[model samples]
Target: MTQQSLSKFEEHLQDILQYRVEKELLIIKNYPRIIADYDRDLIIELMESLLNNVYCFAEKTITITITLQEKLLIIYVKDDGPGFSKKELLTATEPYYFQNKNSHFGLGLTIVEALTQKHVGNLKIVNSIDGGAIVSAVFAIKVENLH
Candidate 1:
């Protein structure tokens, strides 16, 4: 893994965000030039999944934060929308488990969760205290590889 600029990730996410016409989505990136051994493809997949989920349900805006801890890369995708029910939150990442059986095919979070695990990472879905859904992905990183 090589160190790379996260601007590329932001660009990719913006492209995905632009697809939603109804919601006034806002992506706030509070990040430095995050240099680390990160999997670009997996990260893109994560962002795409989060963006799509938000666009489908979000009412006003979506805020994203990407930050790095000592040896962890954390990405937070938050939306000001009605959050998941307790039952939905529990099985959200499970493959083919959709809250509304008549609505979606239910593969987005499953793929995101799979890719995250493949990269030795974990995904958390919770409702923010401020009122919204927050999907956080924490990836293990090797800081020594940063340039």
Candidate 2:
């Protein structure tokens, strides 16, 4: 893990967006200007996995929000798709659990959970009462690292 600026992370997200054009989905990101100590590659992989999973079900827009509260860095990825079913909300992060048996291998959330935990973080999967699905990753960070 290394200290990384969110700007650099956003740049990586833009690069990931280039290869995905199956849907006309608009990705909106809200990130504060802060640095956190995290594995850059693993965070990127986590974001990619979140985005890829949402892409398969998102209607038009996806939002990525990053915020810092105290010593925790919180990353949330939300989609304008059908919210997860109850069963999915419970088992989505389980290995080899698939909501749709056709296209997905069912490892995306599982991977995200693992990556989050690896960084001393916890993952939350929930359905927005308004609509869509929201995945939140919260990581412990050094308070001094905030800039």
Candidate 3:
């Protein structure tokens, strides 16, 4: 995640989630200060889609966490929902592939994957050991003043 003020991004995320989640439980882990280069609008769109997918399957709570490493930024959106099947894991990000017939265009993960690549990032979807889905978006950030 890149922002002049990352808190603004967090606020934006909370707004979107609050709107979509209605009265559901949401746990947003406080993020530390992180400054990097990123497209604000694109990040917002990416997060919106990710949250939408989580909302689709979430039962009660959703958790959002962000971590910044020396050369990477990782955001994990975890939900207490049914995890993905083996087949879904492989093709979830493929265009026009819908696990649920009534779901959205199946473009949520696709767009996220594309945006991640565009920013030299990676996307991972895994089933949490606690029996939920965890979607992680990892971005490579330029490290300054390397020895």
What overall lDDT goes with each candidate model? 0.78, 0.81, 0.77
Flag clash pairs in model 1.
Answer: none
Error of 2 at 131 (Å): 0.9
lDDT of 2 at 44: 86
Can you rank all candidates by lDDT, best first?
2, 1, 3
Expressed as tens digits, the lDDT of each residue in 1-147 for candidate 3 is 344555566778878866664436555554456555666676778888888777778888888887666667688988888888999999999999787778777888898889888778899999999998899998776533322
What are the per-model C-alpha RMSD values against the true structure? 2.1, 2.2, 3.3
The positional error of residue 116 in candidate 1, measured at the CA in angstroms, is: 1.1
- Residue 128 of model 3: what lDDT? 98
Clashing pairs in 3: none
TM-score of 2: 0.86
Worst lDDT 10-window in candidate 2: 23-32
TM-score of 1: 0.86
Error of 2 at 60 (Å): 1.3
- Tens digit per residue, CA lDDT, model 2, 1-147: 777786787788889887876655455555457776767788888888888788877887777787777777788888889989999999999999887757668888898899899988999999998899999998887543445
